[model samples]
Target chain A: MDHIEHLEHTESPANMKKQIWNTFYVLLVLTVVDIALYFALLSSHSIYKNILFVFLGLVKAFYIVSVFMHMKFERKFLASIIILPMLFICFLIWLALTEAGYTFDSRLF
Target chain B: MSNTATLSTDNKQTWGGGKSPLSISYGKLMMWVFLLSDAFTFSSLLVAYGFVRFTFTTSLPNAIVKPFSHLSHTFTEEMQKAGLFVTERWPSPELVFNHFPFLHGIHLPLMFVSLMTFILIFSSVTMVLAVEAGHRMAKKEVEKYMLWTIIGGAAFLGCQAWEWTNLITEGASLQNNPFGPTAFAALFFIVTGFHGTHVLSGVILNIVIYINVINGTYEKRGHYEMVEKVGLYWHFVDLVWVFVFTFFYLI
Candidate 1:
């Protein structure tokens, strides 16, 4: 009976559906923006173009993990446990790019 | 040594027990750890793709032929006449992935892929809905959302199959391609094939869970943790696709 009461007291299904639709709309808008930027920056050699793409991609990724995966509602310690390894991934990216740069230089020179 | 021994004794009292340090269940914690390790595997693959692509592009020769030249013989001739084929270092992804469903022969660059991305993301939303329904112990709602989620997974897999078929039929293989560099075809196949395999497995897993939902397995267990666990995997797959789209196609 207490569990039944708790269910009734919690957020309604309509409210949950609203939140889901909001997230879907946000993701759809981001994707449209991403595709537009892809074409807009197609011929440009600017470094900022790549930076913007990565930044937007990360934002989308964060939303999916946090909301869709419910990581945002998880305990802080659990969130950290899942997210901390990303630092090591960043280190891997840095190392790989640096090595690639060196390889390119050597091949060219 | 004596000081370290004393610290070890103190640590045992506070942290050495078998309790879950993060206050999550053992199953969920294990899943997170598995996903973390899986993330590393994907990161390494994408990093390798970056390294190969950078090296290939920087070292490309002048006057590279357009990709899929054989299929575009007339266009290639016109481009050759216009001296357009004399430009470009590596094959651009926009040109490579331009084919759309049933719009064959039209240059619809990124349209099909964007549609695929939308489907995957929408399916992810359904997955979260399923999890939400599970939390409320709404079995009917859970079943409905889970069915939608399963259909989404299957559809994504079907799209991937179509994409792969087009790639192969258009002359891209692990070893060779009409594309600029051999490594281009190789990395494309490896990274996307790995992801396709994941989606296939995810679809199968979703079907299993959907069946179990219909069987009242979770109701018998008195909780819907299974839905939440599978949701983590599904969301992880979508997360990886976001990175794959950005790194492989957009940039």
Candidate 2:
């Protein structure tokens, strides 16, 4: 499809502007909450706090990718192209954590 | 014989490979592929950081070093209040990243980095505005928003330079630090430095595109796809910073 046709099919300038502002506000609020949690959980050594941070971070990341990067407007195949690699990334994280745990145990024993 | 062969091929209609199957231009698709690979690179670095941090926080110290040992003691009362104990030797992020601009020796925790984060996010907003303007074929608006985006990027790079200088002044290198483990400093520099390089290149790219926009290059082309492509890259940079800020600073 042509550019003007694509614009008409997806979003007008005003609608796109609204989405942008909405995302901006959402990201700002999330960051504010993160900062608050940082202070609230400062003295605690809980893994839950870390998990919360990661979850909030992922939320922000999703908003940016979908809205700001315009991935949401793209075709499903393109979106999948971007997302499929993330599974491999999760695998890498699991591997790293496992190795780290093994090393930590060996050092301790 | 030729008519029969043509009829067979026309009926088969092999997938029209020339056109974008995803309804996107090849340029945009290539950009997505590049970004996906870049994300993998960043994930590897961050995962490595996680691994090192886990190991450092779990292993017993050979000996409690001087300043960090003293530093750990200062947090003992608060840790006790929270029902936690200092069992390992990872340097506290709060103490490590407490410097603020023009407030030498004053501890501001994460104030400066938070400001930097806001700057980068604001830049991402401007980038989207630019892309939106491009979609509307508003060249002047696109120029304005692109200029703001570039300024925000440059400002972030300046903040990062100051942060790096502060860290170096505090004797942080890849090999060693007085705070806790050397890996802490090493990963901090490597990950953030790599991100800083991205910001630098983004600013430069924006400037180049800004010049072209002003010169009516995209205006002549009948479509502002270039601006949208660059916008994708800019947003990805901001997205990566979100993770970096969380894993490196807040956690």
List DockQ, one per candidate, in order.
0.36, 0.44
Once fitted onto the true fold, the runs of candidate 1 whose alpha carbons sit more than 4 angstroms away are A1-16, B1-20, B58-88
Error of 1 at B189 (Å): 0.7
Q: B64-151 in candidate 2: lDDT tens per residue?
A: 2222233332443443343232334676666667677776545567888889999999999999999888988899999999999999
Cα lDDT tens digits for candidate 2, A10-75: 344458889999999999999999988887777676788889999999999999999998878765
Question: Chain A of candidate 2 scores what in TM-score?
Answer: 0.85
Q: Give the Å error, residue B72, model 1.
A: 5.3
Best by lDDT: 2
TM score of chain A per candidate: 0.83, 0.85
Off by over 4 Å in 2: A1-14, B1-18, B58-88
